[model samples]
Target: MLEEEYQPRRQLPVHLRPPVQPEPVFEFTIRDATLADMPYVREIYNHYVANTVVTFDEDAMTLKEWRTKFSWVSKLNMPFLVAVSPTSTVLGFAYVSPWKQKAAYRRTVEDSIYLGPAATGKGLGKALMKELLARSKAAGIKEVLAVIVDKGAEGSIRLHESFGFVEVGRLGKVGFKFNRWLGTVLLQKHLK
Candidate 1:
């Protein structure tokens, strides 16, 4: 018998090992937000507000302030949607607001989408946006704009681009957060 050549099994680095698959924790349902959903929605937004320059706000919104915002969006007949779990846990929320306080800009809206840190990277954002944009079209919206932070938001930029948004403008070093300068990328999408 011929002697077999000695070969050793290759060992992979610990970091290069296959990732642990996360369990399916919840099923999300996208629907118009109710007054009851405001608190959870505020919680999600406050996460970003407190930790990031995403909203340029350093303070959290009080319940009353959240109510005022809900009322304002309702007054405009804008869609304020939430993604919820089967047990009624809010995973994310999205809405549209006036891009500018002028009659000429009434048909154009600025969209904001926020997801709980745990709820991201699982397609919840996309689902909420699909419902949001559909509602916008039904509400006669002509354009939708997204103002995204460009520092560490590549996923956000990619998501918007996947939905046909085009970068129309960029403001460099326009925001300061965590002792570092940040930039804003403005993207727009037109609906027919």
Candidate 2:
């Protein structure tokens, strides 16, 4: 009898395999956000809110609501930064918000970062976070917290961890989205 060659099968189908995403071709300039950047900023965030479980919000926020939120951050004098391309396109944004409304939480801020669909997989997110953290430290912030979705957020967790953030806690099944229960992972970086 003739021996036959063995063949291996792929667990993931070809169409289901992850796509090869190229690194950004353009360099990014990180800077403090301005009122003019709100539209682009909102656009990036709405993309995540609409398409992914990355954000717990199931519905996309209106521009008016986003502007209000931005105004609030500005009023608090927190750092709201945007990564712009050479052409002035907003590639991503990172901001620090009060962790809670109480005065006791004033020194602690929660970080929220959103990258344009095309801007991800590049170093923009990390660069933005570094700038935001530096600014927060300079502004006398004591701690920065990141509450990230457990699923589809490994990159975010890794980015935070790379910047000295450690996982402080995890909340299982705390969110329901896309017909499934999702968890949250809380990470903290002490700046003081």
Candidate 3:
């Protein structure tokens, strides 16, 4: 009997597998929102109201309420921006609204930003805020204020600080959520 020569199967080295690279963070083009964007806008807002401390409101606004809200912002001539991809998916939104009901406060607007859970931490919030501030200044807004729930949201505070926002006030135990009272910190960036 002749013994057959044993052969080993060829194997590629471990390093030969293409080195895995991190996914590139998504980029957004900020633009004026249209009626068609209401659904997406609602989705983003509701996401925060449901899952985060970014917003104090516990109840999500209905579509009709959202429409009215956007309409009011438009009437103020304030910028309402929807951060969208090339495919037109709204990842997040930002806007300025009347800081107070008094006419003397007309020049000051409160700023709000909401991002889908997946959209956070990729600089979408900062981009949206930067564009919103530009539009606010163009429209003669004097001050931009952010009321933040201060549960150590360092990322958000840092983002605002990077844009010249300074802490102006803090109200302790003003917000109730998740079976606890949360403090509210006011951050303002003056454009004028």
Q: What is the TM-score of each candidate against the true structure?
A: 0.86, 0.86, 0.89
Candidate 1 regions with alpha-carbon error over 4 angstroms: 1-22
lDDT of 2 at 62: 81
TM-score of the candidate numbered 1?
Answer: 0.86
Q: State each model's CA lDDT, in order.
A: 0.90, 0.91, 0.88
The true-versus-predicted C-alpha distance at residue 83 of model 1, in Å, is 0.6
Off by more than 4 A, model 2: 1-24
Q: Give the higher-lDDT candidate: 2 or 3.
A: 2
Judging by lDDT against the true structure, name the best candidate. 2
**Which residue pairs in model 1 clash with each other?**
none
* lDDT tens per residue, model 3, 1-192: 335665667877988977779987687898999878999999888887888777888999889998998999999899999988888899889889999999999999999888887888888988888899999999999889988888946688888899999999999999888788999889999896
Q: Cα lDDT for residue 146, model 3?
A: 87
Question: 2 or 3, which is superior by TM-score?
Answer: 3
Query: Candidate 2 on 123-143: residue-level lDDT in tens?
Result: 888889889989999989999
Task: Using TM-score, give the best candidate's number.
Answer: 3
TM-score for candidate 2, residues paired by index: 0.86
